[model samples]
Target: MAALFADPLHDQFGTWPVAYIPYGGADFGEIAAVAAEVGNGDDDAYHAAWIAAAERLEAEAETTLASGHESSARELYLRASVFYATSYHPLFGAPVDRRLLDAYRRQIAAFNRGLALGPHPVRPQRIPFESQAMPAYFMPAAGYETEVRPLIILNNGYDSTSIDMYFLSAVAASRRGYHSLLFEGPGQGEMLYEHGIPLRPDWEAVIGAVVDFALAHPLVDPSRIALSGTSLGGHLAPRAASVERRIAALIADPGTWSIADGFRHAFAAMFKLPPEAVADLGKLDESVMQRAEQAVRADRSMHWKVIQRGYWVHGVDNLRDYLASAELYALAGRAEQIRCPTLITQAENDPAAADAETFFAALRCPKTFMRFQANEGADGHCEMRNRSLFNRRAFDWLDEQFNVEMR
Candidate 1:
């Protein structure tokens, strides 16, 4: 499969918007135009190009709205929101770029405007957390708006926003007659960008609050609440489900057992040390740390991933500290605690899924492990390349698990 850009990082994140095409979050022509404007591996060029595209669509959306083309305006606004959300990935380091903040605000505004114009009643919510509130949106299944219905809580990973979940998961869930809740937790979206909250390992506390909100909602069926996490949420969701028994079913797209797995592998391969030697990244020797740091400095991708985004998300200033913080986010001793039926997915080429089998094997509850192959065109992380297929199979599994007949 040919990539959209010459730069690996650019191609990886740049094509993310295409995943939403089925639900009106983007168009291939619009995404191709932006890709044409960006230079290979050029972060600045990527940021500028996406921003320009988003602004253009936003203006068009406004014009369309003024002319009373509600559907056209709504689609334009939603697509603009996707572009705005796509614009800030390359600028993810701290002291946060003003451009990133501005883009995020624009994304949220456009998304809200688009949803506000849609036929469905989408409600924005603020789930109370410790001394703060987590921003959330509840989109009820059509025809079941006022009745009690099973709900799917969509949790995104390290780099995606709640708006992304709307296109990636919520829309699909809604179409299948399932109410969906899209939210941001600590170190995610609004919590990280606006509140300066770093990522935390104890997701049980974060999800507990979200479950509380779901239980209180008149339209939510408390007995069939499901939690599905994607990317890093793969790990975060499992961690939460381990303790939050209210989650009747759990799904981890390309299941992740530990955040430190990548770090461990990098250290092993970079330093020529045995895997066991780097098993605990938090306890690395100073000499090994110096060498690893220098190696990361020379690699642009690693520099951005480890030094920039990793440090910022973990609220750490150095690689060593980032590694240490990441160690806390593992489900090694907790998988057995999850009482609900779990579905763990693994895409053939998703590096983050290297530990999916191990994680799946550790679970004591009734579980299913799903694998996506390259031949299926669904092997990309979170199966973004073909999310509809993934969602169809996943929701079917959920329906069966909850004993609810498919609509």
Candidate 2:
């Protein structure tokens, strides 16, 4: 877990793809090479380095596929997709940079091509939602491609695409004899980037559509369907599960109490504000908002997280509205409504897991809290450093809850 790049922001984002190594999403040497190429580089340099790696892997995938080595081609294409996905984080802001758009498109293409050649049965889907459709993929469990099998629907948080979800959860779930559905909801992937959709607090409506899709599928076992959300999805999935009773089991990776809660406490600690002053962040006065904006803009990490990525995802034009919009994502009264068997995970060093205990304590369902430690190499956000361990424990719990025989 040592720093991968001198730039803190780069170090954090750069290490994400490493977690995908177990599923052929990357090789540590390739990632290390890219990191060395981008040492102390600015946003553009970071973008250029990753883009170069992605293109190289993509061309290799094409040549390998042409020679009919599908398995090798699958690995190369999937690896390329992860690199392309990693390349655009620094470029995430309004007036979407042309480079970001192009990289994202290539990322999707590589991921889909890889999926077509994978061992499992995969289908690209367009799940019906309000007016626009959410892009999704239904991957039937490897050996149960023609049978009714329990389904694990994977949801990603803040910045990950549906492709990231596949390496993070879907592939693992399929190997365990569980069908998988991975989708991009509002404010994510193509939903936001291609269709102009922004984030929404009412995720129940969004997930309700996903459940409908699963129910309609001949291979998915509706009665045993499970939902797992990671990162910001930690909150979104629970919020939806609260109302979507069809979800028989739930997993929130590093459970979050709310979107604004973390920011509120961080602000209070940073500026020494009294509890009451930072209590209702949504209603902070204009001057206070200006001060917060100034504080965020002063740091490169905070600038991208709050001003650029935050504003764009929330469909807001100013810091105040973004904070106001975040207020809608709270799970205070909502967590108690989730009735399914639930599992919440906490990673030792993940700042987002600060509220995992609070979220776990509030849950009234049959719930379990799983904690990952730094010594286990699974302490980062979402246990990105050692997801093989995370996935094993998570699905084992699901299997127990659903009375599933071990595979």
Give the Å error, residue 352, model 1: 0.4
1-407 in candidate 2: lDDT tens per residue? 78888789988889998888998888888889999999889999999999999999999999999998999998898899999999989888887888988999999998888888866635578999989989999987877788888999998899999988999998899889898899999999998888778999999999999999999999888799999999999999999999999999999997988899878988888778898988788787667777888999998989999888999999998888899899899999999999999999999989999999999999999999999999999998999999999999999999998887644
How much is the lDDT of residue 142 in candidate 1?
69
| Winning candidate number (lDDT) | 2
lDDT of candidate 1 over 1-407, digit per residue (tens): 57777688888888897788898888888888888889564888999999999999999999999999999998898889999999999899889999999999999999899888967646577999998899999998866677778999999899889989999988888888899999999999999999889989999999999999999998898999999999999999999999998999999997999998888887898789987779888789899989989999899888888887899888999888898999998898899888899999999889999999999999999999999988998987888888888988999999998877544
Error of 1 at 176 (Å): 0.2
lDDT, candidate 1, at 407:
46
Backbone N/Cα/C clashes per model: 0, 0
Could you tell me which 10 consecutive residues in candidate 2 have the lowest summed lDDT? 115-124
Candidate 2's C-alpha runs over 4 A off are 118-121
